[model samples]
Target: MFDAVRNNRKIVQIFLVLICLPFALWGVDSYVHGGGAGEDPASVGDTKITAQQFQQAWRQQQDRLRQALGANYKSEEANTPEARLAVLNSLIDQRLLALEANQARLGVSDEALRNFIARIPSLQENGAFSMARYEAALSAQGLSQPQFEAQLRQDLTLQQLVGAVGESSLVAKSSTDAIMRIEAEERQASEFRFPAAQYSAQASVDAAAVKKFYDENARLFQTPERARAEYVVLSQEALLAQVKVADEEVKAWYDGHKDRYQSAEERRASHILLLDKDKDPAKTKAAAEAILREVQAQPAKFAEIARSRSQDPGSANKGGDLGFFARGMMVKAFDDAAFKLKDGEVSGVVQSEFGYHIIKLTGIHPGKQRSLEEVRPEIVAELKRQASAKRFAEAAEAFSNMVYEQADSLKPAAERFGLKVETSGWLAKAPKPQDLPAYGVLGEPKLLKALFADDAVKNKRNTDAIEIAPNTLVAARVVEYQPAAARPLTEVSAQIESGLKLREAAAQAKKAGEAKLAELQKGGEDKLAWSATKTFSRLQPLPAPPAAARAVFQAPVGKLPAFVGVTLDNGDYALYRVAKVSQPEAIDEARRKAVEREYSTLLAQEDFAAYLAALRARTKVEINQKALEASDR
Candidate 1:
């Protein structure tokens, strides 16, 4: 289990499975259709959920997702209006719960939040909190210290709530047994599918039927709610692009830091140590002296002498070669003597800690100065970085003022300042615009607070220059608006058509497969006709890949309904009859332990949901729907 948890691929699969598990309880089929007054964001004894808190939590969740998936993250399946709304509502629900938790006074202390931040790897250096690193990261993310603190505080509060509920959860042995039994059980089955295409010939769509369907579900075709927005975005990278570094500045910088470019002297030398003092000190010295004299007479024979007589085991095997090294890299006495010798020169026998060593200078490398031309590129980069920092600050301040002064119209401000007015219609404020580098600023608590302010909503006015991030300010005003309403048939006709086509296909497939299943059960058809396929246990690979198999397994096992029919992704239908079900049994000890852990998790989740519900039922909540709509504009 530990190994599975440690494996990257396994961990990822587990994480995804865990994330999806919530849908089982939440009921994925319960969808938010178009819009209406959603359930109260919160409901205390007398107060209701407020727009301000909802937006705040919503923005926080967005930031958390961005942080988890990276700035470039987008949900591939959520591009359509329905899918997008589903994701947005899920985020909103989480926020609602978090706000409720806060109102119930289920929050973490400041000290706890501080400790948590300090322990985070991203904010630590060598296992300790690094103020410098924390500051730099906050700067990169375009966040102020206070903003980060507030976010951390809120997160801590939510965690506290979850912890409280989870702590109270209890898992009984019987519950674990049940879960274990299901997890380890296997099912035997066969399937038949009924294809809709088979029935298309018999099922004709008439104009009158189409008109009736459209009339009954007219709301499905209505246009989606949309709001026009005029927003000013400040990104450091954009500001940096306009900054230019001068050659003179680069040169001056290079001059000031010239000392850093100097290279140190290095020596390449070898020794023929003809001594081993540990055995006999006097004899070792005499042997060294003798070998030194011999090498002095025949200098070129030093390499041969080293190989045959040197007492240094490692270097002796390699002709006593000590590869090139800087002054401080070698032992003090050996280094001093070697450096003193000129290139290709020999030295007298020197005495030191190991023994005595006759040194020879195989080569000498002189220290040299690195010219300014060699490091001009580095200098230029430094200058540009400095210039960019200044540019971003100035541009941000100017951009903020412009948006604040010209609230309703972005054209006037944009044209005058040569700045582009970015427009986003009904964006949920998470996984923000990919093209805008500073969009993370929108996640800041202060920016959320200001954007949802009553004045900004009532007047449909631009937000004041609010610092969403360091060196980045944002101000936005609504231009166009649409109150949430049930969608009309015209607007959702295409969507309904697609849904209808899929359901029809499934229905047709099931009908045909049902007949096939009945024939197979009557022992009238070959098993091969059912498509030869691998049989799987309930705990094995998910049957999602084989929808027909899933449908058959889910059906009650009975002789009367001897077979089940369903559609497969390959545009085919399949019919399956129940073969046999393994008797429900207690799990083995090992499996039981695992199931116990899972049961504990399930209980905790249930408790947490209940806790959130209770919190929402007792909080002071007020919402400015108009303010929320205005900010998007």
Candidate 2:
């Protein structure tokens, strides 16, 4: 039922990915920080990294991974010492950037901050910013608008500092051309195989060898424990469909929140901004007035003039179009000038905090009241969600108690909460995150651990209900269990013997291939039979085994018929004859441009890394081991 600002609102997303992938954090040297209110996981200079700070950052990273990977997210994997260290390091990097930015007196403007927040997809509704949705999102995250705005401002300031550092990075023309030449060179080659299978007859493993190898590698022959389980999930989504919202409630909500449903009067405007860089405001105003006269004489050419003359980086490229915005969204002078103009009318020269502006009003959307019928479905859904949340909270405790009190069956809790008890196929004791999707919600680590626990597996009991997600609780019972066991030596003897023989055969093949390669390099004639020739380069490569292809590409092309050999993991040895080398007739212009962009990006990444390392070297850091280890919560 809540809707506001019906306009095509676009934000200039001022994001610059100048650093390395994932993150590039500052290095730290440890010291001690005493007399703190509580334990700190880490500290940068005088600033302490609180447990709450570390955990929040960790949770945000985990949430991003979960959204990006969907069902493949592993909570346990992220809650590791390594991940915690990375998270703490990122926070330190951010702090360093903030410190540098503050000292540099860098700042983000009101318009930039509003537009940046507007660009957040979750805070938007129907392709526009919604005040109610923004409020709700902040509430859900336990953040106030001021708190969020402060963090956002700090982030934008960091962007400014880092973007400057990254954009300053330069790539040499010679470097780019050299890399292009190296990648463009192609070599024609044919393979000569020294097959390990040919040497298998001479390779042997006696009883003493097999017994010793088998004894040392006992775990290799053992099978991991597996289980099949039945589980039930209790979540707000499960309760939402069942919790009905009455027509009366929907109508009452719409009537009470009519003010929230009023679409705002938004104006679309384009402007040409002129900055007084040399502290000469009078000159800047005169220049803006001249542009204003030109714009007034020919309103149709306002965008064209703005594109060439406007100094605003945020909007000049788009012909100075700031999209549609409500009143008071801009600075006071700019706002008044923009809203006063009629569609297709150009405004007189206006002065604002940024600079002088010549404004042109392009479009207008008038304020309108939304009808009750139009917002009924939205009101119903909101009411349903509210009711579901309250009901879910009450049922969650009962669900947990029933699963533990009864301790034998999940049916009591399932039937009481109207949830279905789903069964899974064989589940591993410690399944890889990629394999967890097969088990559904039972893939949750805590539930899986409970399913295979001694009490549950030995005495057929239901697991204690665990909150797997925000509002999702799960309890599972082990239906079938398989304990970890090793295969008998008698059963594995043949397999062991074959493995030993194959390994020895591979060693022999490698030795022979390398000897031949050495001889060929010394100008000795090879009587070896070669296979059909095929061409390859760095860009276009061979299939199947990649190690052999890598060896070929990396081999020197100084002499004709140069030789290179590689031992295969599967017990085969290959020697390649580098017969010919040639370059393409013409290098594609588009591919050259792509490489230029990639090389520039690489330079930017390295520059940013060096900058961070410099900051870390000067800044003192202290890490509390006990607090860090206890932060698994």
Local distance difference test, each candidate: 0.60, 0.79
Superposed by TM-score, candidate 1 places the C-alpha of residue 403 at a distance from the truth, in angstroms, of 4.0
Q: What is the C-alpha RMSD of each candidate to the true structure, in Å?
A: 15.1, 9.0
User: Candidate 2 — which residues are off by over 4 angstroms?
Assistant: 1-38, 43-74, 94-174, 197-209, 240-387, 511-519, 522-524, 583-619, 630-633
Best by lDDT: 2
TM-score of each: 0.45, 0.68
Report lDDT (Cα) of residue 205, candidate 2: 88
Q: Please, what are the lDDT tens digits per residue for candidate 1 over residues 491-574?
A: 655655555566666666666666666676676755544544345466567554657556755766655334566667755666
| Candidate 1 stretches greater than 4 Å from native | 1-193, 201-225, 262-370, 394-402, 405-419, 423-458, 464-474, 490-505, 527-566, 569-572, 575-633
